[model samples]
Target: MGQDAIAPPNGITHIVWDWNGTLLDDNHANLAALNQVCAEFGRAPVELEYWRAVFRRPLLACYEELFGRPLADEEWARLNQTYDRHYSSLLPSCRLADGALQVLTSWTGRGRTQSLLSMAAHRHLEPLITERGLTRHFTRVDGRRHDGAHDSKAEHLVQHLEAQGISPSTVALIGDIDDDARAAREAGAHAVLVATGLMSRARLEATGHPVADSAAEAVAMLGD
Candidate 1:
C-alpha cells in the first residue's frame, strides 16, 4: 500500500496580499514606462518576456540590468523619476488582474481576515486603493514610506503583522514573485505565489512554495 503525497502547508487564519503585478495588473504600463525611460538614455526597448525574466528587487538592480551597465546614484534617480512620471500617467488605464476582486471578496465572506502590503510609496498607494474602493476589504493597507524605497518586504511584513496583533504563524502571504515567498518565510508565515507577475511558473516554483496561476487559485490552496 502507498501513502498519499503530502499536501502543501496552506492552512491559515489570515491572508496578506502583494500589490503591483499581483493584483494591479500594471505589467503593460510598467513596461511602457520603462521603455520610455530607456529611450531617454538611448537604449533599445525591451520585450516583455525579457523584462519579466530579469525583473527583481532592489529596483536599482533591475534598472541597471535593463540599461546594460552600472548606474551612478544620480543616473538611477533620474531614470526612476522619468519612469514614475510615465507610469503614473498610464496607470489610470490599467485595471486589476482577473479574479482579483472575487478572491478578496470570497476570502472576506468566509469570515477570515486579509490585508494588503506593497512596496509602492505610501502617499501614492493609499489614494490608488481608495479610488478603486478596495479600502473596505482590507483590515489594513501598507505601502513603503519612501525612505526605504529599494528595500525588501520582510521588514515591512513584520511591522504589518505586529501592528495588526496578528501572529505570523497564522498567516498566509500571496504574492507574484519569489521575494514574496522569501519575505513571508523570513517573517514566519506561509507563502503562496501566483504566476501572474513578471516571474514564470518555473522560476516561482524554484522558491519551493506552492504556486498558483491566479489569485482565486492561490486563496483556494489555503483551504477553508
Candidate 2:
C-alpha cells in the first residue's frame, strides 16, 4: 500500500507506537552507538544507509551480521553494555521527529487511545518519555523489563493489547522496522511503517506494509 493508504477498510481506534525510530528522531544516536561498538571491536564504522538496510530485531543477529561472526555470551553482553552507554550519552542531544508532537496532540484531541511499545528497557524508556514531555500523549507506556532477555515485540504486543482490553482488530502499529510489522501481524493488527526513521523506504516497503514518509503522513493515513 502507498503512504496515503494506511487506513484499513476496517476501522481503527487504537495506536501502538514504536519509540526509538517512530516518534523519536534517534536513529542518529542509534547509529552512533553502533559505530562506537564497532570501533571497540576493530570493525569499520557503517554508513547510515547500510545500517538502515541491515537493521533487524533480536538485535544480536544484526550485531553478528555486522561483526561477521557469532558473538560469545560475554561478548554479546559487553557489546550491549557499550551500545547502551553510548546511546544514553547521546540521547540528550536527540529530538523528536518532525510533526511528532502535532500528530500526537491531534490524536489525543480526537480521543484516540495510544500507547508506546518499545523493546528499550523500562528503566530507560520511562524517563526518556518524561524528559521529552510526551508522557501525557499515551494512555500507556511500556518497555522491556529487566527480568529477561527481551527480543521481539510480538508477544509484548499481545500482552499490551490484552492489558488494555483492546482487541487487536481495532489497533494499528506504526514503526520504522520490519520487526514492528511482524509484531503487528502476529497480533492481528494493522501495521504502518514509517520511512523517515530507522529503515530506508525501500527496506520498509519490502515488508509489504504501507510506508509513510513522515509522522504527519502516517497520522494522515488514519483519516476521519
Candidate 3:
C-alpha cells in the first residue's frame, strides 16, 4: 500500500470533510488560478488530467511542479499572495456540486455530527462556507491559516481531533484524494473517498480504501 491501510472502528459518529475539491468542486477554479500564476512566470501550466495526480499537497509543491523548479521561501510567499488575490475574486463563481448539499443536509437533519477539515486557509474556507450557507450544518470548521502552515490535511485532522474532544474511532474523514485516505488511516479513522473531485475511482481504489461515487453515497454508507 502507498500508506497504512486501516478499517473503521466502532462508534463512528462524526464526519470531517475535505473542502475545496471534495465539497466545493473548486478544482476547475483552482486549476485556472494555478495556471494563470504559472503563465506569469513563463512556466507551462498543467492540464486537468495531469493536475489530478499531484494536486493534493501544499500550494508550493503544486507550484514547483508546474514551474519545474523549487521556489525560494519568499518567492513562494509572493506567488501565494498573487494566487490568493485572483482566487478570492473567483470565489463568487464557485459553488457546491450535485448531491453535496443534500448529503450535508441529510446528516444535519438527522442530528448527526459533522465538521470540516480542509487544507484551504481559514480565510478563504470560512467565506465560502458562509456564502454557500453551510455554516449552520457543521459543528466545527477546521482549516489552514494565512500565517500558519497546514501543508497537509493530515496535520489539520490531528488538530481537529484534539480540539473536538473526539477520537479517530468516533469520526470519519471524507475527501477526494489519496491524502484524505492516508490521513484518515494514519489517524485511525474511517475514510470515505469520493469520485466527485480530482481523483478517479481507479486511483482511490488502488489505495485499498473504500470509495463512494458522491457525497450522497458516502452519507448513505454511514446510515443506520
Candidate 4:
C-alpha cells in the first residue's frame, strides 16, 4: 500500500459506498456470528472492540489471527461456510448505520450519483439492501460473485466504476477500513474513511485518508 495521504475532496461527481460495516450497523451480528463459528473451532468469543482491532481483508488472515494457526485449504472452506451460516442467521436483526439513510436520501434528493461496492457476496448484499428499501438509492450495487476472501477492493472499484461508465478520478469512496483507503488510492479515486464500521477510528486514520465520525460526516467532509 502507498504511504502518501489522500488528496482533498474536490470535483467528486459520484460517491461509492461500502457495505458490511460501513453502511450496515452489523457489528453485533458480525461479532456474534464469528463467535458462533469460533466456538465450533474451539476458540473463545470476541467482543466488538477486539473484533474491530483484529479484523482484516483477505479474511483468511483474520481467521488465522484468531485461531492462532495456519488453516488448511479444506479447513478454510469449512470455516467460511460456518461463518457464512452464522452470519446469515444474524442478518435479519442487523440494522443500517446511524445517519446512513439521510446521507443516501440527501444525495439522491440532490440528484447526484452514488453506488455500492462491497466484498460481501452479491447474493447476500443485494437482497439485504433491497430488504431495507435501499435498492433505489444507488446507481449500481456489486458484491463478490464467487466464493473466497477478498484481498483488496482496488480491482473491484475499477470494475464498478467501469460498469457505471464513470471515471475513477471523479469518484469518492466512503468506507470503513484501511483496505478501503488503499483501494481508492490504487484505483485512482478519492476516499473518506468512516469510523462507523468494523475498523477502529485510530486504524482508519492511520491510512492517511480523511476519517469521519459517521456516514453523514463523511459526506459533509466531502463538501456535500
lDDT of 2 by residue, 1-224 (tens): 32333334247788899988888898889989989999999899989989888888778888888899999999999998999999999998888899899989988888778999998998999998998789999989999864334587888889889989999998989998888988998999998889977778987887778888887887777766
Cα deviation of 53 in candidate 3 (Å)? 2.3
The TM-score of predicted model 2 comes to 0.93
RMSD of each: 3.7, 2.6, 2.5, 2.0
Flag the better candidate by lDDT, 2 or 3: 2
Q: How accurate is candidate 1 locally (lDDT)?
A: 0.86
Q: How many clashes show up in model 2?
A: 0
Q: Candidates' TM-scores?
A: 0.93, 0.93, 0.87, 0.93
- The TM-score between candidate 4 and the true structure equals 0.93
Model 1: which residue pairs collide? none
Question: Which ten residues in a row are the worst by lDDT in model 2?
Answer: 1-10
Quick one: RMSD of model 4? 2.0
**What are the lDDT scores of the predictions, listed in order?**
0.86, 0.85, 0.77, 0.86
Give candidate 2 regions above 4 Å deviation. Answer: 1-10, 146-150
Residue 2 of model 2, lDDT score: 28
Worst 10 residues of 1 by lDDT: 1-10
User: Which 10 consecutive residues of model 3 have the lowest summed lDDT?
Assistant: 1-10
Write one digit per residue (lDDT tens) for candidate 3, span 88-144.
Answer: 778778788778888888787776789998877787678778877889988888777
